[model samples]
Target: MEKSYQAAQAFSGDLSFLQEPADAVAIRHQVLILHCLAEGQQPISISWYKNGEPLPPSSYIQQLLNGSLWIRNFQKRQRNGTDEGEYSCAAQNRYGRLLSRKARVQLAYLSRFHRNPQPMAVAEGSVARFQCLTTAVPKATIIWERNRTELVTADPRFTLLPDGILQISGVTKDDVGVYRCLATNPANSRYSDEAWLTLTGSAHLSHQEPVILSGPQNLTLTVHQTAILECIATGNPRPIVSWSRLDGRSIGVEGIQVLGNGNLMISDVSVKHSGVYVCAANRPGTRVRRTAQGMLLVQAPPEFIAWPQSATYAPGDNASFSCVVEGVPQPTLAWLKNGKYVEVRENTRLSDNNRTLTILRVTYSDEALYQCIAENSAGTNQASARLAISLPQDAPKLPEKVIAFPITSTAIQVAWNRPSPADTDGIIGYVLHIRRAEDPSTQETQEALSKMTFKHKLMNLEPSTKYALFLRVYSPVGISRDSGTIFVTTRDIVPKTPDFSVTTVNDTSIRIDWEGAPPSSTIQGYKLEYRKMPCTSFQGTQILPRNQTSFIYYDLEPSSLYQIRLVAFGNSGDGNDTHRFVSLRRSGKVVPDPSPDSEEEHKPTLGLIFGVCVGLACPVLCLLLLFLLYWKRHLCKRKTNEGCGHNVQEEKTDQAIEEERDRNSEEPTELLSVNPTNVAEADSSLGRDATRVKEDQSHEPPHPAV
Candidate 1:
């Protein structure tokens, strides 16, 4: 146990050592050493290694007494590549071992250049490289220099390689210079021999004009055929040639190809290719350019581009027609009407190189079929159109005299002559218009008839009424203007007898009164007549206008019976008569005259009687007295009787009755002063007859007195 404790103490102290020496360098034939120190209780061993490997005993390498490594001579040729490496010394004790820090031993010698840079020749815009090779004891770094100035690697145009190579790209005339490469290390630095660079090509312009070897000429070809145009040029360095159209359009290689010798070739040529073409030649690095022009022609036939179209215009309006044609040779145009050549008229004109025709102030006569004819050396073609004129329509003329007649009491027949043909285009039908004269809106009628018919019958009209009528004609175009209006009336019907009463009666006069007829009857006047009872006709008649409702008759015979009648007249004629009978008589007592004895007291004496006898003896005086008395009494009675006998004729119109009255003398009859009592009795008797007449009419059919 004492020996084991002693061994442990020894091992702990054995690992202690002294510091080693740093790295070192040496020249050829120079001496070197690597050394370390260690202390321990047991014996310590030491070893030497190079680059982590054991070093064997060699003639130039030896170990010293203090455990250090030694190199006697550093010879590069005899070292066999092992002279340059890391060297280390290791020491150990009974418990542990320790390695000293490594130290490097490098061999050094002066540089020896093997090859010098050679002279170089390159064209402008080419690449150049300079080379320098050398041998030395240590590795060396290479550098480039141009024109005695050091060059940096940052320059893009010049680059320096690790093996002493200098390169320059895109060499220009400015880059022509002398260049050198330097080899350098810690021992010494050496430079290669200088070299010169030469550039062969030129980059300057020359003053010379370009020349054309082959020429440019005009070309003509048919449609859809191939065509070729040639152009060539010569210069110091052959000139570049190109083809272009004069209209400034690019020519493609699909249909039009440009050859290397400046020639243009076209396949399937068309009318669009017919234009001037230009060829240009230019030399690089010189102001030498030349140009030439050539024309291309293509043949084609006539083709119609636009044809004539139909047109319509009114009178006094302007019209125009145009036709367009395209051909190699221009086409000629002409105008024709109705299949014949149209000559220039007063208002006709032509313009636009005879391709258009114009008409001014057109008329109805100008309406016709028009044709446009186009002709050329190739062929001829034509187109036609119709031109029409429009006119206004006119109204028909008035018809001839119109007449209307009564067909019945409530209907009428109307007739007229047809209108003249000159005033109408053509009548298709006629129109008859009828309306009531009093109130047009009350009743209206319209009828349409064929063109041949000229009369119409109006029916279903009110009796005793008037109507207004007019006519109109119609055609396919429009209706004609209204004709003159005329008035027509329907026939009037007979009226019932009027009821009359006797107002007064006298010895020779009677007074009677009656009521007016109905308003619808259209009564114009009234008539009254009377005669003795049982007489075949009336002895006297009175004509009264429509305004009078009462009448009186005088100079009637006393104590006599008479018959009376009253009638009403209208637009048609006299209506049925109302009859009556009456008697006239004296109703009062008569008075007597005084006797001659009462007149004797108021008479003259005997002398007056004697005077009267003497006056009577004169015959002329007695004859005149008797003749006067006889004429007054006898002639007046005879005239009165004749007037009463012919009074029936008074029923005539007032105009005829007035003429008869003018022929008679203006004298009063003897019976003009009859008694009022006798007149009143006669009127009363006449009233009874009127009542009987009305009763008789109610039981029988009415008879109108014409």
Candidate 2:
């Protein structure tokens, strides 16, 4: 890097253009110091020779256009002046010292004894220009600074005048501070006392309406080109302004344009322009500026980032759609089948909020690209996202809706349909997941049926409870999303005691059957109960497991109506539902034998005919007996029928028996008369017969009907 350059004074000695210092050198450092006359009135080769050399390196030369030169930054170690020879500086390369040009010094102000610094004023919210007017013995250099920092004109918003005026755009509260002017000559350097500018108002420029604040807003700027984002803000007593990126110190151009207009005039606009930016503006006399941010959104095609939020579901199921997009306006969701719209009957719907599509009863055909569109008043954008519907890669439907009766403590059996609408590839298998309500929420889906459907019976549950049984069905999904939730319920019922009535009772045991109420919980199996004929404690009470409804007690007490109770057990709870009294009858009472004479006299007319037909019925009776022996099952059935068939016959026989008893209730009195003559003879025999009559009466048979 060449640090030195041959110089020519193209303008006044106001080194203002070089806002900051370059390498300012002095006389002691200069190897060439020629105080002699030019020896001629010619524009000499104003070049610098270093280390006593005739010419500085050809590389150490630069033409300062519209620029000036007058050095005064000199101390004991360095020198700077224009005495026709104060323009040289020396440099030492490995080769030795080199001398710069002495004639490079140009003094055009030999006639001026003094110069005044430039003066300017601007409102707090407006632009300002300051002119530097100063003096020196010969030609002098001038510079401007605010708060010790040099100012520049390369700034697009801050331009410089040909005379020596500093132009500042969007003057702010910070700009109200005092400014300093300096003048340097070959003799010495002098600084004018600081000039304090009393600014009354803010310098923040603000647009009234349809304008962006702080940073650019409502941009009507051209597209594709760098846009200068300008904020139009209005605050009482305008403010100072500066531009910056949302996260950085400054934005827009550099050096000459770092802080200007409280805006960043971009060079090229691309898709990246869509973002937020910040700017600082302060009211007059305030150190803290009001900062604001604006967004830069570029119009472009919509980038669709969407998927089926709920992908895995049963054949007859519904799922929600998730759509993400980037564009001017928010996107609208649509269900696209083969790149087209779906009909209303398909049960597919778009959500009112966020426009997410929903598919009910999802099927294989529901797989396709769903287009989302984002459009602004200017144009429209579209994006495509693929949606897939698949079966659960888990177990099949289980016996669901099973719940234990809380009071009965009985379990219920639950079952349900399995997942449908699986991929044509076929289901791998299924597995059943059985758990309590307090179990972990997460469970894996499988492809094995043996594991899927479960004959789950809930236990340790409350009785008299209508419990809920949950079950699900699942299938394989090659590249399918996971199923959300499968749910179903077992039949709910109230708990009741088991009907443990005695079917048969023996001296030791009793055979019993349960006819109790239905169970509430999922009933996977059953149990039997028994006890001693008179039991006071559970120690004597016995319970046996009977897969069937009926159970036999072998050691039951005979002839006792045992106090017994039956209860159904389930997951929910237990309850006593059935009760029975069992006892055996004994045959020990007396009965009289019917007399033969009584049978003859008491027989009804039908009985007389039956007696007469007995001989004739013998063959028929034998035939019937033979038939019954051959077909025992039929005879059993007929025997049951005989009871119903003889109802009317029994009623007629009862009526006949009633009538015969009524007729015999009273007997007629006999008269003791006979013929006169026979009477005398009868009298003599009667006396003798009387004695025998008493003896005969004791042994005589019952008389026949008259």
Candidate 3:
């Protein structure tokens, strides 16, 4: 059984997370736990992170075996450390890694009200309102108290908003008493400043429209600072003042409050708070109001979110650096080299809003420290990275185990394994050195090859010829020393005929069947040529895959003779051809010629099958007999050498041994003794007996060598 393992499955269920940390609010000095559990490949490790950085191990903060973070005596504020900010966890294994959702950890505490309930005088039977707002994490709950007693909020006459505002309708004399806000949270509870609510008789009170005594003025401040917009108003029965953004954005209650009757105070202001503010003063129970407006501009200095990373590259390669900054008004970006501005040209340019700098076809002189500067109205910032140029001194190692095979009479296939990964770093491509055995090195032809290619074919060469070949590996720096030379002899141009039989399938179709060749990568496909008999010119050709051995030729003239040819092809070129002539009658009956020259065509289908079987088995028997003869001869030579005390033996190099092994595995010994240079003796007894089948087609004799 195979062992099962899974990497970080990302969102897949294999590496499922049972629980993840969530936003939490804990009281100071209390223990807090954040959960992160995952299941995946064995030997998985879990790590905790805080504020986007790894959290250092400490006694105060510990990670449990189950991948949960436990904080002891969690501190909201400390001189050295604080238990706050965002927290996340990661589960990792050798296969992959995954990160969990980020969770914010905040101390739970409610601050004293920036603005407490103030004394107000109003007429009885009119609506009355009171406001109490405080800053708190996880939000604080506020309850109204009448004379130290919890007010009945269940009464329909009272309404409470999420922001700690209280409203009362049909105020009676019973409402006249000391009123305050009691705020409670996970940390502690406190009461706001007490204020007495007084009411006069409706008839005795004089009504007046609300009026703004002062309006907030425009203010500007930097980030992480505070801004105050003052708005004071007065009216009979007192008016209620509220704040809003002119752009219709929320006047968020966090770090924001109304102080001293109607003043707006914002703490820890950021660029997001830069907007126009509108303050409205309205009389209680009526829409009569006055308004004031102010603009608060918050500015921030340029800060980098993405920086260029250092890298190394060879000459003629492209190099690029990117720098990204975020600030108010979207900071402008610029590029510099070694503290000086870089000249912009066609080869060196900026893109993507001037945030990216690209140097095309970088040369050695282009190597330098690249800097990116961003400037805005607020401030400027810069970051830099170094670009190092490398000119390798060592070329790539030579190709491994180079060997060549005779693919055809005029073509040879050369293949080699790539060098080990460690020796291939700077490799750009390969070069083949080809020459005849008797030729000078200066006369050798060089063929360039792609770095990724491992096998190549050398075509259009002389048959029955000897050639010497070697390989050279090239890199950006230089070329490697030539590999050991290997010699290969091309085969004589003698193509073997395919044994096939043609049978009529219909009035216009006849199927040709042949035995398939043994599986070999070199066998590319097969070609089928057919036409009417005695025409010399073929009509058309059809190519079939190497695995296919049968084809049907259709749309032939009825009662007409047709000649069909089938031949196998390899990477080199076409092989021998088998031709057969068939005649179809008007009744769709097929007939074969019975001429003495075409005896095999007159055989039945069974006889054709037997012939094919015998033909294939003959090659195997011949190969076995040749191996036996070679082995006997080798044994006899060894015995004779031992008997004569002749221990002389030739030493073979690693390259020579590999070449010998490849040659024995790929090539078969030819039986004929014919020499390429002596064509006059080609018809000798040895050639006639060695095995060359005679083709006796009626109109065409056997094809001789070209």
Candidate 4:
């Protein structure tokens, strides 16, 4: 335990006394020691004091190595001075010093008897008493002796009170004696004059009520000090004394003691001990009593429970500083700036008791070191803090690594990295600027963005158009520089309308089937619109989900020409419309529909009719020539032998040619056909037939252009 205590004390830097001096008495010429031990940081020194002043250097007195004062030769009073007085010591280190509790030191001695025992003659079978008193450094103990020998009062009738009063009840001839009082202490002893006690005629003792000789008086002291309340009483049978709080509180015995016949003493008093104390003296075994009361007031030094802290804030912001202290008496507080008294103005205000100081719309001039001073009857204390005003130079930096991209044909998403918290301490929000690239005549639009979100989407923008974007961060003081510009363009061709075919399902309904394309993120849905021809206005437009590729229209009018339009829609807007014309027949027969692109072309004219006529006549003429050639060939086969059978080699060649024709006829052949819509198709067909005939004559010699 001792080692642990020493270890703790060695590291503790605050001055604390391990031992303090206490009240003591010394014999004349005897050695005296006043203890004053403390622990703190290294390099500690000790000093002694006497009677509220520094002790002068002397050979008779000196401080010991353990921070104690030693008086080699103590004296009660000398020609020059006395060694008896209030003495205290202090221990000092680099941190601070602490003074030990003051102790009263006095020399012990017994003085001559101030009042001797008076000779008394008491009646037999009655009460008789004798008294003795003296002055001593410590309250001396009194002893009674008869005939110069120690008196033994073993009889029930004999009694000795603490105040040196000897009482004898039922006194007979045996109680007669010559008595003397003695006062003794550790220092010395003294004897009082002797007197004779004799028996006389019958005597009567009167009963007296309890009467308070001295009562407690009002007093005030600081906390942790001692308090004494005096209460003395006298009565025929000696009153019994007790103490209590006038407010009915218990006088706790922790630091309480009864001193000298009935006085109350309390040690280490605190604020809770401050109250009116009641002292009562009651006659033995009776209700009769006498009471006295006095008030005690405890005060404490000013100590801070809260202190102001240094802070930095942007200009035009309200700043507050607070200081709170506690004490027995409410302390008065004052404000200071830079070690000087603070001047109050329209912008500056102080709370009740000057505990809080507030500055409104603080500017550069309001920045300074601030202090709060608190004072009371016990002691004074002060605390300090600093206020700083932020300037434009301290504004947040521009956003880093800004980027932008298109989310759809008309929407663009922008994002950027946030600056570090230390650099953007006072930033409130961000501002984004957007405008068409290379178009100074266009108005730039600005959007205010929340500081918490680093990404923002710009909607309702023109498709296939480029935009320039930049960012700026702002604080209460000012805004930062603009970040580097970034460019992004919205997509134009995405979510294109899919081609669809319309077919009659019934007399009143038509079903549409469309080719599906790969899914795109920008595609939202599809819109279908249809209208009767010649009206030029669509009716009953319907929106379908993005994944749907087919739709059925019901309750359509029969025998009517209707135009249908389908388009894909997304965040940007609807894409190009696909238009088709459908004709419904009233007879319930569905006609084959022409290609959607052919519906826009004009009908054939007179030139197309003439070309069609020539094309029809040429085919008929070819058939007629083919029939005539066949008949002529039959006749020639019969008449050819007589006139043409002259050369044998010629006949053989003709037979070979017939054989060649027969072999060619075994192969299949194809004939050309045409449905001429214009003169160009008819001419194209005639040119193709001529080219084929020329190719057939390639085996013969080349013919001239006739």
Best by TM-score: 3
The CA-based lDDT of model 4 is what? 0.67
TM-score of 3: 0.35
Evaluated against the true structure, the overall lDDT of model 3 is: 0.67
Residue-wise C-alpha lDDT for candidate 4, range 1-706, written one tens digit per residue: 0110111123334445677787789988889998888775555566777876778667688788887889899987777689888886655443323455557788998878888998988656555667787888877888889888877878766666555667665678877889998889877898889999897764454787877766788978788888877676666676888998988888788999876557788899988898999989999999999999999998887789998766666767888889999988988888876434667889999997799999888775575657777867765566666666554766667688888899876899998887787765677889998876523235679999888778999999997786777788878867765675576788664556777766666656666667665643444555666655444235545556566677777777767655666766544445555655566664433223332223233234334544665777776765565566557655654453232321212212323433332333211121011111122332233323322211111123222221
The estimated TM-scores of all candidates read 0.26, 0.20, 0.35, 0.34
Model 2 misplaced stretches (Cα beyond 4 Å): 1-217, 220-227, 230-263, 266-301, 308-321, 326-328, 352-356, 362-369, 374-706
Enumerate clash totals for all models, in the order shown.
8, 120, 0, 0
Write one digit per residue (lDDT tens) for candidate 3, span 1-706: 2211122222232333567788788778888999998775454556777876678656589888888989988986777678788887765432223455567788888888898988867677555677788998767889899899999988876766555666665678888899999888888888999888888667245777877756778987779988878676666777899999999999898999766567788989998899999999999988788999999999897899998766666667788889889998688888866334678987998899988999888765575556677867765566666665554556467678898989778899999987666666667888897765422222568899988888999998887677778788888776665565677878666534468766666556677777776753344455566655434344445556656777766667666666666655443344556566667664433334333223344346436545665778876766665566557656765653343221122233434433432343222222112111111232132223223222222232212211
Question: lDDT for each of the candidates?
Answer: 0.61, 0.39, 0.67, 0.67
Superposition error at 242 for model 2 (Å): 2.5
On TM-score, who's better, 1 or 2? 1
Q: Write the per-residue lDDT of candidate 1 for residues 1-706, one digit (tens) a residue.
A: 0111121132234344564645677666778776776565345556676775666557788878787778898665653565777776655432223455456777876556787888888656555667788876566888878787887667676655444656665668878888887788767888889999998775332444566644456877667877777665655455778788899876656798764446677889877888888888888766668888888887554466886655656667887777887866576778866434678888999889878888888764575556676655544455555565543455445556777777767888988886665543388888887765543124358888887777888888888666667677777654554455566677766445576654324566666677865544455556577665433345355646555677777766776555666766544555656555455544311111112123343345434544665777865655565466457545754654454454323434445443432332121131121111122343444444444532112222222212
**lDDT value, residue 419 of candidate 4:** 70
Please list the residue runs of candidate 4 whose C-alpha ends up more than 4 Å from where it truly belongs after superposition: 1-11, 203-706
Order of candidate numbers by TM-score, starting with the best: 3, 4, 1, 2
Clashing pairs in 1: 505-679, 505-680, 506-678, 506-679, 506-680, 507-678, 507-679, 533-561
Q: What is the alpha-carbon RMSD of candidate 4 to the true structure?
A: 40.9
Winner by TM-score between candidate 4 and candidate 1: 4
Which segments of candidate 3 are over 4 A away from where they belong? 1-24, 29-54, 63-73, 77-80, 85-105, 113-115, 153-161, 211-289, 294-316, 319-354, 357-706
